[model samples]
Target: MSLRFSDTVHGVDLPNNAMLPPFDDAWVTSWGAERRDGIYVSRPMTLQVFHTRLLEHAKCNNVTERFGVTRDTGAPAVSDGILWGVASWGIRKLCGTERFPAMFSYLASKSNLDFLTNGTQILMSDKRHYPYPDNLFNNRAETTPPSTTS
Candidate 1:
């Protein structure tokens, strides 16, 4: 399913193109308890789309220049940490989604640069970084939305 960003996140409205990537059940489940806790409840496709758009925006706007990234540096080589921070700020100030604060909190807690950098590929490949006992959405009738309260 396609995922669209809310008009605003944390008082910031995202650009019209900030749509998330496609959904994947394996990736969503890989988030483990965070998915169940609602802290990482965004559907896998939705989150991926959001992240892809975030990175594309950063590249188009030269937002990575502030982080010492030069034009010579391949876009893919840029650190996800920088991108995440930039995207997070954008989501907080531009999109203003109510869940931005919660997402920010979750990011702070994880605080792993690699996680953000490799997250897209990892999720897309349906690989799990950490073992989860079960897929929370597997048995649920509604795998999206209503299942997540956050």
Candidate 2:
């Protein structure tokens, strides 16, 4: 059976390029920041759920069926489409349970955040990504921890 928006995971199927609007809005919200505020924060509610939903869609949906590939004989079963690798990265964040150095690197690339920014690295450590609608707002980093450790 084909995966619907809700059946496979926690996602809301949306129009094409659904993620664009939300991302742009988020970027605009933090426009005044002198630093890289475009780098969003993810928490359990936002990031984890959003990430899971996207990954589930990827696994359930056939790569060939969505985006066709060509054989050595040049036979095409599917046509070219959006960048699936980037989708996979979003999936990884959803499935991830613990924070590691690599996760930081991955989100950095996906979000186009500067690697040199100390704030970005800190955000990666604190927040997590979720499975969300049309890849919009996948992460919600915890703004306040239970306690602060100095």
Q: Give the per-residue lDDT of model 2 (tens digit) for 1-150.
A: 976556454321211211222221010001111212333343223211111111232333322211111111111111021111222222222222222101111122233323323453432222223322433234333222223356
Off by over 4 Å in 2: 1-17, 20-54, 57-80, 86-138, 141-150
Candidate 1 residues lying further than 4 Å off, grouped into runs, are: 9-111, 121-150
Over 29-48, each residue of candidate 1 has an lDDT whose tens digit, in order, gives 01111133223334344322
TM-score of 2: 0.15
Model 2 gets an lDDT of: 0.22
In model 2, which range of ten residues has the least summed lDDT? 24-33
RMSD of each: 19.5, 20.4
Write down the worst ten-residue block by lDDT for model 1.
Answer: 25-34
Candidate 1 local accuracy as lDDT?
0.23
